[model samples]
Target: MSARETFTDRWMTAMSHAHRLLLKASRGQLGATLGPMKVVELHTIGRRSGKMRSAMLSAPIVEDGRYILIASKGGDDRDPFWFSNLVANPDVELTVGGVTLLMRARVADAEEKAALWPRVTAAYGGYSRYQEKTARDIPVVICEPR
Candidate 1:
């Protein structure tokens, strides 16, 4: 679901509508978004177990063909389920549209965070609000194409 269309959202139809809209723009495929941010399927090894975990997320493109993703988990008090998995294993596969690629992942540092967060928040405004609800700083993971 998109940021505006959470599982707990009041308007279920709105969420469905959005998913449909995206699918159509994508021609029933992936990577069909407005701009800067693209939908990518990320596969990461589980932190506790070695099993693979997957999720589709929109990450903003930053410098050097890298992407910035937040572990907001829809503003939950805890980090996203995938966050620790990435920490334990930063190497990941990204399926963007029809292209499957490898991306080395690392949580952005203070300077990088300062530079990238605004770009991310601009693409998805909810991220700023997500930060406001949590005490811990939200992490921005950079996925560099490899």
Candidate 2:
């Protein structure tokens, strides 16, 4: 990884840790929402280690009981680790607003992405900027109740 990418990864790791701590410290009262997005704790089985892993992510779009997540990784060229994990094992657990539910995750197909991209960028323009920073097409993930 380039120096900038390495730094970004480290920063993201730290922020996720802090976010989880905040949620735990507040007993799910705080860190549940961020700006216009809802924060969710996504748990997936590690692809290589065969262990459970989790990440704190924001749901940019929630429609028809489905949560849409962006696998931007701050616009990194490589896919995020969490994204790979979910691809290997779609069965996941999502915790939102102190409610935990079993969910299945899948990458949105091209047609779905085309329709949702505008809404996602509108919800957070930063996502547009993130897309511009990388050559790879960032994936849009959908998590639905299982």
Candidate 3:
């Protein structure tokens, strides 16, 4: 298989299995296998239709009691569509560590971004590579509990 195909296979196998486990149980055995990494659910409003939508995400850690999510889109050239949704509506609902909270998201200021970006990205290694793959700066949103 080609290198790209191999990468695609690995991604498919891991995500599909994880997704299945999530549907079956709120906290699955894989959570234990993956250390502090946990699946997060984000609820956002559609930018065009204003309809509500939810997506499952993998996060590394929570810092200072705040939730952080990167708009990586798995290193795609385009920012995730959800990113635009957040841009249109900063308020979001998120489930983290099995708890749900309403949060207001604001794109981090550059100074704050400089300090927090490294810490957040280091917590999840793939984030750095994702940033490298895209020309645009991947946004890191700080979601404060509301």
Candidate 4:
């Protein structure tokens, strides 16, 4: 059973739907870039409903054919729905710059997160502020091309 939506959840859902619509209308071109960061469309199977769900996320670091995503959720205490879905099913699809590819997602361990945290903060300083806003340990997810 789905939980009742709080005001924050409702707001987030509305914004996500709008972004998704824009992303789809442009064939993943327009909304693919957010300021200095590049955005990618992550497609995953819903953990409960078993349906495809897409989220636009910033890929602050891409190295060695791996795309790194931060599960900051704007620093919310709870993990994002997409993060949960990714954890349940690592295999997913990603559309970057209009090209879709199969990928495997995994949460970075504490050591790995520590190593990449600097790079992540450097890429976007706003993340640092987000970290300060919440007590939960934000996750760093690595998506490698399959």
Query: For each candidate, C-alpha RMSD in Å?
Result: 5.3, 1.2, 4.7, 2.5
Q: All candidates' lDDT scores?
A: 0.74, 0.93, 0.72, 0.87
TM-score of each: 0.76, 0.94, 0.77, 0.89
Summarize candidate 2's per-residue lDDT along 1-146 as a digit string, tens digits: 78987898888889999999999999988988888999999999999999999899999999788999999998888898899999999999998877888999999999999999999998899999999999999999999988
Per-residue lDDT of 80-99 in model 4, one digit per residue for the tens?
Answer: 89999999999999888778
Tens digit of lDDT per residue, candidate 1, span 1-146? Answer: 66644553434335435654676587756444536667666789998889987666678664567767788776766666677888889998876665777888899899989988888888988889989987879999988887
Error of 1 at 37 (Å): 2.0
Residues 1-146, candidate 3: write the lDDT tens digits: 67875675467447745674765585554443234565667788989999986666665557676777777777766666667898899899986555678998778788877888777677777889988887888888788887
Sort order, lDDT high to low: 2, 4, 1, 3
Candidate 3 TM-score over all chains jointly = 0.77
After superposition, the stretches of candidate 1 with alpha carbons farther than 4 Å from their true spots are 1-31, 34-36
The regions of model 4 sitting more than 4 angstroms off are 1-5, 26-29
TM for candidate 1 is 0.76
Q: What is the Cα-based TM-score of model 2?
A: 0.94
Q: Which of candidates 1 and 2 is the stronger one according to lDDT?
A: 2
Poorest 10 consecutive residues by lDDT, candidate 4: 1-10
